[model samples]
Target chain A: MKKIINDPFNFVDESMEGILAAHSNLLKAAEGNVRAIVRADAPAAHKVAVATGGGSGHLPVFLGYVGRGMADGCAVGNVFSSPTSSQMKQVTKAVDSGRGVLYIYGRYQGDMMNFDMAAEDCAEDGIEVQTVLVTDDVASAPREEWQKRRGVAGLFFAYKIAGAKAETGSDLSSVRTAAEKAVSNMRSMGVALGSCTLPTVGRPTFSVSDDEMEIGMGIHGEAGVQRCKLENADQIAATLVDYVAEDLPFCKGDEVAVLVNSLGGTPLEELYILYREINRLLTERGIQIYRPYVGRYACSMEMPGASLTLMKLDDELKELLDAPAETPFFVQN
Target chain B: MKKIINDPFNFVDESMEGILAAHSNLLKAAEGNVRAIVRADAPAAHKVAVATGGGSGHLPVFLGYVGRGMADGCAVGNVFSSPTSSQMKQVTKAVDSGRGVLYIYGRYQGDMMNFDMAAEDCAEDGIEVQTVLVTDDVASAPREEWQKRRGVAGLFFAYKIAGAKAETGSDLSSVRTAAEKAVSNMRSMGVALGSCTLPTVGRPTFSVSDDEMEIGMGIHGEAGVQRCKLENADQIAATLVDYVAEDLPFCKGDEVAVLVNSLGGTPLEELYILYREINRLLTERGIQIYRPYVGRYACSMEMPGASLTLMKLDDELKELLDAPAETPFFVQN
Candidate 1:
């Protein structure tokens, strides 16, 4: 494996150490728990605390979002593995204010189980905690089974709206409502040109022939709905956009916040190309784009692919989306 | 080659179209010249314009930096090729106010030739233009011959400082001096585990064994000073830091800004891990880090590697670095 890591076994720990060192001004390890990272000014009084956690490979996700206007804290885990409930509870306690905490994350089995358990643990300590699982990958399930779908890049929308609500001193239930609304109005799909290698595995998680592409692949290399000969950017964009837009039934005059996210190895230039096609198609369909973000917001480690996310926006959602946010990985004004 | 692109010959044009579509609020193609991109609010009266460009494929480098408090315009070129002098001249004219324009880019032969010709072209048109060629890759030349070195991630430092200076209404000479000083005090070196493929080429630019790495490789897959077995992140960090530090002869009390830039395929998590080691070694050497940035600030399309840049800063550079700036690819407050 051509990874620049000291020990594959310590990849998660070492990476967490590095994250803290580089972003010392913005983040800090939760007191007494290295696996839990919190904003340096966490536990602010009377504000609803927002927290998320998941596997470690996706930077700017779980940990990178913990800052002033985003998640107040995040529990971290090993590569593609969920953080322990203990870690989650510790993070919950670290960031919880008098208003309580809201837990948001992708709808993976391991993640759901851990966060659920942590919620129960926090309850015993009189710390109110609510959960909102993101289910926005349209290809992972039919419309009737949307709750079964996995979360993808659309989680960023959830983070933004929910974090913005919590930052406004909303209660835990209000924050949970905003997060659920964000997830309910979102859809995402991806096309993977190549596989990613987990540091621990020391090899690619999966493989694809040179001329093939996998559509709707999961962030952790989960099986996609289709595998076919590689296609050009326009075709790929059409496939992804059609699936996501149709799932949401986005219509003429509807506004959206578009995220053309890189899946690790895809360059921003390509993402913009995909975004161009997406914009053209959406415009043709008469859908209005309120805001468009193109970059690596979420990613698998070194996977060559891109994902498209469309979050149908309402006035409240738009206001929240446009609210100022500052984090190591993301900042907006 | 598994890249999400249309006809190879149309890659640059298509990507530029996408960029204009996604960032129309912040940027627009220059009138009468699609290959020249300018800020939507370009030609701000009496403000010295800052512009930079080179070969394509490096996102957020040339065009992505054109926005408020950064570059005012940038010339676009085909992948791994310099923009024509005509295109540069058009962009210079598009952004220049009464104060003048500053041209900054890497010291590649094609870039130098084209930019020099463009400067002359602008002179003939009575639009004052000054040039500051970035030479910061310590591995490309010895200290005595630093002017012959190639630019790398350190170019971002030059952009930030000079852009900030220009945004403050500095004159052409002042902006030029800030850019030159930034280039003079900066050093960078990279290690590539695999080569990046140009869209038009449709194949890897160069090849390396899975167990080996090339140190100090250029953005376009140019040869480095050494090729050896792949080393751990700490060892790689030490080698890169040692080379750049020794070249500057950075003193024990020097304060510097550090950038751990991903060469496309390397994930931010790995860059942070690399940054951790870099921080340790620099601190051990008594070099204090002022501002640290770790991300894909500069890239060679999907190449599996990273580069380290150190910009030794004085009070002026520090103030300029801290100035607020907002662009599609970068934002600071």
Candidate 2:
């Protein structure tokens, strides 16, 4: 209940309003539809357009990535709820530049169904559409059935690489391939010390004892793999890294882009503390860190937790990720 | 006590270690002195150097500002404690390129005393040192005694302007004037819904009842001007903006830059929600928003609150603010 919002029901729309208002030069509402946002110069001619969408609350996920060298458009959903197929179709049609559209989003039941419907709807208009469902949360499924897993912070990697590929005037198939490559090589896991309340709910989504932490918790407070007593930063880093690295069996020589993402309430200082340990443990294991990103890339609504994501990178992905990107929430040079 | 840290006393040092490890290309310890960090390419031949330092918990405050177009060096401090005069002097000498050094930091007693001492020591070495104490927190003092007010997030503005001036090869006096101008035009105030626990203390710095909130609370949980029941976002924005704008008496048709900074724990979504309202109010008041920044530009560990800052802009300030700057924590293009 302790949140700075006007009407709980207007949370998503109002947040979108704030974003568009702040970054009008970089982003805009697609054809006056607040639910469908696209880059200001969205339908770039002959360039493969990358579109993404998901439930709200995770800023910089779907909408925050809508900009040059990132996703071309985003269908914004309600807080922790999927957007409608109509909204998704609007974004798809708005950003399609005759080069086709590529959909990159988290692997959630509601999202999968909605995005699929949007793709089918776009097909009738002759706008070729491809989907890459990011399933990189290792704890959500066994390694053999990784596609059934949930996507968490690993969505960032898929977007970065896929968006870069699309920006290079690549064909839709190539962009989709780059996205799929990122999803296949990524693994993420999180530990929640607290839960965030949905604005409409007016209560915490879940709870953890004052002396405990839950590992593998979903962004929506879904059941985590285990509940354990609170541990120090290094111990927490080791546990999360072990779960992530072992899932990919990220070998000794593998290079990775590490993202230590704050779920919502954790401070940047703690993320760095966690990152230092992750850097040490990975170096000890002979794995090189290609680039380390530490901040709130993905989040629950003021939830107290941090997730660690590792995306094994090849030369292609390295170039793609290093490409400049500018968005309302993310900027790189 | 819910934090990710090991050996609370080692919190500052470890966090600094993490920063160095992550950004070795842009920052490095001065002469193996971890407490004194300078830009990787410090003493940029004949350019004026900017040296800033304060307590450690506020990431991206002093240390985070050291970079190519920001502060050239910083002396690290323990959580909520000032760095020693000796450490400050080391940084001053490390970054000085025979052009001189400008000292910019908050108007805190400990910081003032330490920085003054450092300047005195550096003066013995014939290194000209100028100081500008940021006193932008309008809630901290009456306008008649603005010099006694505490500096909060306004430090970012001073750094941006002063750093840009120095990058232009301006002499020390001109660089100091730019910082002073920014400090004079800026006003900031904050509201706290919850408190952050210092690692060594292992408890909330201050407590607010679950149903109550404090307005104008300091970054270190210092007393504010008011405490009342929780209010909605628009009302909160109205109060904060009124204080900031009226204090400067920001006139009609005046263009200004707005910074909506999270203390730490507040989510970016909430910050944007607040920004949307502030933008509406400013527009209604005939005030123009030049460049709006909504994020954790300054933070207090994991405190749940936010501060609003308004800096009236002129052509000169606008040009300097728009100039490019890159650091470990901030990047402007």
lDDT of 2 by residue, B1-333 (tens): 788888898888888888888889899998888889999998878899999999988876878889978899999889988999999999999999999999999999999999999999999999999999999998889988898999999999988999999999999999999999999899998999988998988888778998888999988889999999989999999999899999988889999999999888888788889999999999999999999999888899888889999999999999999999989888887
Against the true structure, candidate 2 reaches a TM-score of 0.99
> How well is each residue in B91-178 modelled by candidate 1, as lDDT tens digits?
9988988689999899999989999999998898898999899998887887899999998888788889988999888789999999
DockQ of each: 0.82, 0.77
C-alpha positional error of residue A81 in candidate 2 after TM-score superposition, expressed in Å: 0.8
Q: Residue A270's C-alpha lDDT in candidate 2?
A: 86
- Candidate 1 stretches greater than 4 Å from native: none
TM-score of every model?
Answer: 0.99, 0.99
Per model, kept true contacts as a fraction are 0.71, 0.63
